[model samples]
Target: MKEFTFTITDPQGIHARPAGLLVKEAKKYAATLTILKGTKKGDLKKIFTVMGLGVKQGETVTVQAQGADEDAAAAAMEAFLKENF
Candidate 1:
Protein backbone atom coordinates (compact mmCIF):
# COMPACT_ATOMS: atom_id res chain seq x y z
CA MET A 1 0.00 0.00 0.00
CA LYS A 2 1.04 3.59 -0.64
CA GLU A 3 -0.35 6.72 0.92
CA PHE A 4 0.19 10.45 1.17
CA THR A 5 -1.59 13.48 2.57
CA PHE A 6 -2.43 16.55 0.58
CA THR A 7 -4.26 19.77 1.26
CA ILE A 8 -7.18 20.77 -0.99
CA THR A 9 -5.86 24.01 -2.36
CA ASP A 10 -8.60 24.72 -4.84
CA PRO A 11 -10.91 27.48 -3.72
CA GLN A 12 -13.96 25.43 -4.60
CA GLY A 13 -12.63 22.37 -2.87
CA ILE A 14 -13.32 18.83 -4.07
CA HIS A 15 -16.47 19.56 -5.96
CA ALA A 16 -18.09 17.70 -8.81
CA ARG A 17 -15.51 18.31 -11.52
CA PRO A 18 -12.50 17.53 -9.39
CA ALA A 19 -14.14 14.57 -7.78
CA GLY A 20 -15.11 13.25 -11.19
CA LEU A 21 -11.57 13.71 -12.37
CA LEU A 22 -10.32 11.83 -9.34
CA VAL A 23 -12.67 8.94 -10.02
CA LYS A 24 -11.60 8.88 -13.62
CA GLU A 25 -7.94 8.74 -12.69
CA ALA A 26 -8.55 6.12 -10.08
CA LYS A 27 -10.26 3.92 -12.64
CA LYS A 28 -7.09 3.75 -14.69
CA TYR A 29 -5.29 1.76 -12.03
CA ALA A 30 -5.73 -1.84 -11.01
CA ALA A 31 -5.25 -0.92 -7.35
CA THR A 32 -7.92 0.04 -4.91
CA LEU A 33 -7.79 3.74 -4.27
CA THR A 34 -9.33 5.55 -1.35
CA ILE A 35 -9.47 9.06 0.08
CA LEU A 36 -9.56 9.84 3.77
CA LYS A 37 -11.04 12.95 5.25
CA GLY A 38 -10.82 13.08 8.99
CA THR A 39 -12.31 9.79 10.14
CA LYS A 40 -14.23 9.26 6.93
CA LYS A 41 -12.83 7.26 4.07
CA GLY A 42 -14.36 6.44 0.69
CA ASP A 43 -13.51 4.66 -2.52
CA LEU A 44 -11.85 6.90 -5.04
CA LYS A 45 -13.32 5.09 -8.03
CA LYS A 46 -16.84 6.14 -7.18
CA ILE A 47 -17.84 9.73 -7.63
CA PHE A 48 -20.77 9.49 -5.27
CA THR A 49 -18.62 7.97 -2.56
CA VAL A 50 -16.05 10.73 -2.88
CA MET A 51 -18.65 13.51 -2.99
CA GLY A 52 -20.36 12.08 0.03
CA LEU A 53 -17.28 12.89 2.09
CA GLY A 54 -18.07 16.61 1.79
CA VAL A 55 -14.42 17.57 1.67
CA LYS A 56 -13.78 21.30 1.70
CA GLN A 57 -10.91 23.54 0.82
CA GLY A 58 -7.86 23.61 3.08
CA GLU A 59 -8.78 20.21 4.44
CA THR A 60 -5.97 17.71 4.56
CA VAL A 61 -6.94 14.39 3.04
CA THR A 62 -5.01 11.17 2.74
CA VAL A 63 -4.83 9.35 -0.58
CA GLN A 64 -4.24 5.64 -0.23
CA ALA A 65 -3.67 2.98 -2.85
CA GLN A 66 -3.25 -0.72 -2.33
CA GLY A 67 -2.46 -3.42 -4.90
CA ALA A 68 0.09 -4.18 -7.54
CA ASP A 69 0.09 -0.65 -8.98
CA GLU A 70 -0.22 1.17 -5.69
CA ASP A 71 2.81 3.36 -6.19
CA ALA A 72 1.70 4.49 -9.61
CA ALA A 73 -1.78 5.18 -8.32
CA ALA A 74 -0.43 7.29 -5.49
CA ALA A 75 1.88 9.20 -7.77
CA ALA A 76 -0.84 9.90 -10.29
CA MET A 77 -3.23 11.12 -7.64
CA GLU A 78 -0.55 13.32 -6.07
CA ALA A 79 0.23 14.81 -9.43
CA PHE A 80 -3.42 15.51 -10.11
CA LEU A 81 -3.86 17.31 -6.82
CA LYS A 82 -0.72 19.37 -7.40
CA GLU A 83 -1.73 20.35 -10.92
CA ASN A 84 -5.46 20.69 -10.52
CA PHE A 85 -6.06 21.65 -6.91
Candidate 2:
Protein backbone atom coordinates (compact mmCIF):
# COMPACT_ATOMS: atom_id res chain seq x y z
CA MET A 1 0.00 0.00 0.00
CA LYS A 2 1.02 3.57 -0.66
CA GLU A 3 -0.30 6.68 1.04
CA PHE A 4 0.11 10.40 1.45
CA THR A 5 -1.25 13.09 3.73
CA PHE A 6 -2.89 16.28 2.56
CA THR A 7 -4.29 19.36 4.24
CA ILE A 8 -7.36 20.82 2.64
CA THR A 9 -6.83 24.35 1.34
CA ASP A 10 -10.15 24.91 -0.30
CA PRO A 11 -12.45 27.27 1.51
CA GLN A 12 -15.48 25.08 0.95
CA GLY A 13 -13.58 21.91 1.69
CA ILE A 14 -14.36 18.78 -0.29
CA HIS A 15 -17.71 19.96 -1.54
CA ALA A 16 -19.88 18.53 -4.28
CA ARG A 17 -17.94 19.51 -7.39
CA PRO A 18 -14.57 18.42 -6.09
CA ALA A 19 -16.00 15.37 -4.44
CA GLY A 20 -17.44 14.35 -7.75
CA LEU A 21 -14.15 15.07 -9.42
CA LEU A 22 -12.30 13.13 -6.77
CA VAL A 23 -14.53 10.11 -7.21
CA LYS A 24 -13.99 10.36 -10.91
CA GLU A 25 -10.25 10.44 -10.48
CA ALA A 26 -10.31 7.55 -8.06
CA LYS A 27 -12.20 5.43 -10.53
CA LYS A 28 -9.35 5.76 -13.02
CA TYR A 29 -7.05 3.66 -10.87
CA ALA A 30 -7.03 -0.08 -10.51
CA ALA A 31 -5.95 0.29 -6.89
CA THR A 32 -8.37 0.66 -4.04
CA LEU A 33 -8.37 4.12 -2.55
CA THR A 34 -9.53 5.26 0.85
CA ILE A 35 -9.63 8.68 2.45
CA LEU A 36 -9.10 8.91 6.16
CA LYS A 37 -10.05 11.75 8.43
CA GLY A 38 -9.45 11.05 12.05
CA THR A 39 -11.16 7.71 12.70
CA LYS A 40 -13.50 8.15 9.78
CA LYS A 41 -12.76 6.48 6.51
CA GLY A 42 -14.46 6.75 3.16
CA ASP A 43 -13.98 4.80 0.00
CA LEU A 44 -12.53 7.10 -2.59
CA LYS A 45 -14.73 5.58 -5.25
CA LYS A 46 -17.87 6.49 -3.38
CA ILE A 47 -19.08 10.06 -3.56
CA PHE A 48 -21.56 9.82 -0.70
CA THR A 49 -19.06 8.21 1.62
CA VAL A 50 -16.48 10.89 0.90
CA MET A 51 -18.93 13.71 1.47
CA GLY A 52 -20.15 12.03 4.58
CA LEU A 53 -16.80 12.67 6.19
CA GLY A 54 -17.51 16.41 6.09
CA VAL A 55 -13.85 17.21 5.56
CA LYS A 56 -13.33 20.85 6.25
CA GLN A 57 -10.71 23.41 5.40
CA GLY A 58 -7.47 23.20 7.36
CA GLU A 59 -8.11 19.57 8.23
CA THR A 60 -5.55 16.99 7.27
CA VAL A 61 -6.54 13.79 5.61
CA THR A 62 -4.65 10.67 4.67
CA VAL A 63 -5.21 8.90 1.42
CA GLN A 64 -4.27 5.28 1.07
CA ALA A 65 -3.94 3.37 -2.14
CA GLN A 66 -3.67 -0.36 -2.10
CA GLY A 67 -3.56 -2.89 -4.89
CA ALA A 68 -1.67 -3.51 -8.09
CA ASP A 69 -1.19 0.11 -9.09
CA GLU A 70 -0.88 1.61 -5.64
CA ASP A 71 2.39 3.35 -6.34
CA ALA A 72 1.11 5.16 -9.36
CA ALA A 73 -2.22 5.82 -7.72
CA ALA A 74 -0.60 7.32 -4.65
CA ALA A 75 1.54 9.63 -6.73
CA ALA A 76 -1.39 10.69 -8.82
CA MET A 77 -3.58 11.18 -5.77
CA GLU A 78 -0.94 13.33 -4.11
CA ALA A 79 -0.65 15.45 -7.20
CA PHE A 80 -4.39 15.72 -7.43
CA LEU A 81 -4.69 16.85 -3.82
CA LYS A 82 -1.95 19.41 -4.27
CA GLU A 83 -3.51 20.79 -7.39
CA ASN A 84 -7.08 20.80 -6.20
CA PHE A 85 -7.18 20.94 -2.41
Candidate 3:
Protein backbone atom coordinates (compact mmCIF):
# COMPACT_ATOMS: atom_id res chain seq x y z
CA MET A 1 0.00 0.00 0.00
CA LYS A 2 1.16 3.51 -0.76
CA GLU A 3 -0.11 6.35 1.37
CA PHE A 4 0.36 10.04 2.03
CA THR A 5 -1.33 12.78 3.96
CA PHE A 6 -2.34 16.18 2.66
CA THR A 7 -4.03 19.07 4.36
CA ILE A 8 -6.94 20.50 2.46
CA THR A 9 -6.23 23.98 1.14
CA ASP A 10 -9.39 24.70 -0.79
CA PRO A 11 -11.42 27.22 1.09
CA GLN A 12 -14.56 25.19 0.51
CA GLY A 13 -12.88 21.90 1.27
CA ILE A 14 -13.75 18.78 -0.74
CA HIS A 15 -16.99 19.90 -2.15
CA ALA A 16 -19.03 18.48 -5.03
CA ARG A 17 -16.92 19.55 -7.99
CA PRO A 18 -13.59 18.45 -6.57
CA ALA A 19 -15.12 15.26 -5.24
CA GLY A 20 -16.30 14.53 -8.75
CA LEU A 21 -12.87 15.20 -10.16
CA LEU A 22 -11.32 13.00 -7.53
CA VAL A 23 -13.67 10.19 -8.37
CA LYS A 24 -12.87 10.60 -12.01
CA GLU A 25 -9.17 10.45 -11.36
CA ALA A 26 -9.50 7.44 -9.11
CA LYS A 27 -11.39 5.58 -11.81
CA LYS A 28 -8.44 5.82 -14.13
CA TYR A 29 -6.52 3.43 -11.94
CA ALA A 30 -7.22 -0.09 -10.84
CA ALA A 31 -5.85 0.49 -7.36
CA THR A 32 -8.15 0.61 -4.40
CA LEU A 33 -8.07 4.12 -3.05
CA THR A 34 -9.23 5.23 0.35
CA ILE A 35 -9.18 8.50 2.19
CA LEU A 36 -9.05 8.59 5.95
CA LYS A 37 -10.00 11.46 8.18
CA GLY A 38 -9.40 10.70 11.82
CA THR A 39 -11.21 7.38 12.34
CA LYS A 40 -13.39 7.70 9.28
CA LYS A 41 -12.55 6.29 5.89
CA GLY A 42 -14.24 6.63 2.53
CA ASP A 43 -13.62 5.06 -0.85
CA LEU A 44 -11.96 7.58 -3.13
CA LYS A 45 -13.79 6.24 -6.18
CA LYS A 46 -17.21 6.92 -4.82
CA ILE A 47 -18.78 10.33 -5.03
CA PHE A 48 -21.07 10.10 -2.03
CA THR A 49 -18.49 8.36 0.11
CA VAL A 50 -15.89 11.04 -0.60
CA MET A 51 -18.30 13.91 -0.28
CA GLY A 52 -19.68 12.52 2.93
CA LEU A 53 -16.22 12.69 4.44
CA GLY A 54 -16.89 16.37 5.10
CA VAL A 55 -13.22 17.20 4.80
CA LYS A 56 -12.46 20.71 6.00
CA GLN A 57 -9.72 23.16 5.11
CA GLY A 58 -6.47 22.58 7.02
CA GLU A 59 -7.64 19.11 8.06
CA THR A 60 -5.24 16.32 7.31
CA VAL A 61 -6.48 13.85 4.70
CA THR A 62 -4.67 10.57 4.51
CA VAL A 63 -4.88 8.80 1.16
CA GLN A 64 -4.01 5.15 0.76
CA ALA A 65 -3.68 3.42 -2.58
CA GLN A 66 -3.45 -0.33 -2.73
CA GLY A 67 -3.17 -2.61 -5.73
CA ALA A 68 -1.10 -3.10 -8.84
CA ASP A 69 -0.88 0.58 -9.70
CA GLU A 70 -0.56 1.90 -6.19
CA ASP A 71 2.73 3.69 -6.68
CA ALA A 72 1.60 5.56 -9.74
CA ALA A 73 -1.83 6.13 -8.30
CA ALA A 74 -0.41 7.55 -5.08
CA ALA A 75 1.83 9.89 -7.01
CA ALA A 76 -0.97 10.98 -9.27
CA MET A 77 -3.23 11.50 -6.31
CA GLU A 78 -0.62 13.60 -4.55
CA ALA A 79 -0.15 15.72 -7.64
CA PHE A 80 -3.88 16.04 -8.03
CA LEU A 81 -4.24 17.25 -4.44
CA LYS A 82 -1.41 19.71 -4.75
CA GLU A 83 -2.63 21.09 -8.05
CA ASN A 84 -6.27 21.37 -7.19
CA PHE A 85 -6.82 21.15 -3.46
Per-candidate TM-scores read 0.96, 0.97, 0.97
Candidate 2 residue lDDT tens string, 36-60: 9999998999999999999999999
**Model 3 lDDT-worst window of ten:** 50-59
- The lDDT ranking, best first, is 3, 2, 1
User: Tens-digit lDDT track for model 1 on 1-85?
Assistant: 8999999988898999988988998899999999999999989999999999988889999999999999999999999889988
Error of 1 at 15 (Å): 0.5
| Clashing residue pairs for model 3 | none
The residue pairs found clashing in candidate 2 are none
Clashes of each: 0, 0, 0
Q: Which stretches of candidate 1 lie over 4 Å from their true place?
A: none
- Kindly indicate the candidate among 1 and 2 with the higher lDDT: 2
For candidate 1, which ten residues in a row score worst on lDDT? 17-26
Over 4 Å off, model 2: none
